[model samples]
Target: MEETNLYYKLGGQKAIRAVVEEFYRRMLEDELVNEAFRGIDMDRLRNHQTAFLSYALGGPVEYDGRTLREGHKGLNITSEQYERMIRIMNDTLRTFNVADEDRVKIEAFLRSVKPFVVGQ
Candidate 1:
């Protein structure tokens, strides 16, 4: 099987940058996410988005920001919220024409983080 990290190996920073920018743009226009992001700094959110993808995709960049749980602490994210985020993530990958293997890796990573993120 082709390694999922191949996506990162293939496109490096440029590919990750594209996916994150598109993802955040979509989030900004999404009513659910827009409301969730209310009062959050868009610029910082943008950076976090990129750092997140980079970290997950095995890029050289190291994300030193708050832990996912800590950052989302007290947000009380529901299962629905977690599903929506996963859907958005999949859509974002599709928008960038990510390959199936890479998409699988993304899905796996999201699944791994779901419980922590949603407090399940």
Candidate 2:
């Protein structure tokens, strides 16, 4: 199956949105992660995160915003921070009952974005 086809078959837009929401919720409650999100507009950040994930997961939505490196330019996000974000995302996917195959795909996609995200 094609990559995009796999995303749709795995539940498409709605499922991706759910996973993003849960991931942010976990970030908000975890003090270490919460600090990174502090002072940011939760609703706006959440929406952008959703859009980014939608495009990354092979959905039809076209992402046109700044690339992750530029978007995260001044944040100075560390490797540890990136790892925490991935961990939270994986846990959120698990909570949503995402199948292992889909989870693996998502993880690979996220990993590919890490360097850009941290401006490495």
Model 2, residue 52: C-alpha shift (Å)? 1.4
lDDT of each: 0.76, 0.78
| Maximum-TM-score candidate | 2
Q: Roughly what TM-score does model 1 have, to 2 decimal places?
A: 0.85
lDDT over C-alpha atoms for residue 113 of model 1: 87
lDDT of 2 by residue, 1-120 (tens): 356464575587777777777788899998766777768998888788888777766677889888888878777778888888888878888898877887788788878888887843
- What's the C-alpha lDDT at position 40 in model 1? 87
22-114: candidate 1 lDDT, tens digit per residue: 877887787765666778887888778777777767777788988888888877778887788778878988877777777787888888988
TM values, all candidates: 0.85, 0.87
Off by over 4 Å in 2: 1-6
Tell me which residue pairs clash in candidate 1.
none
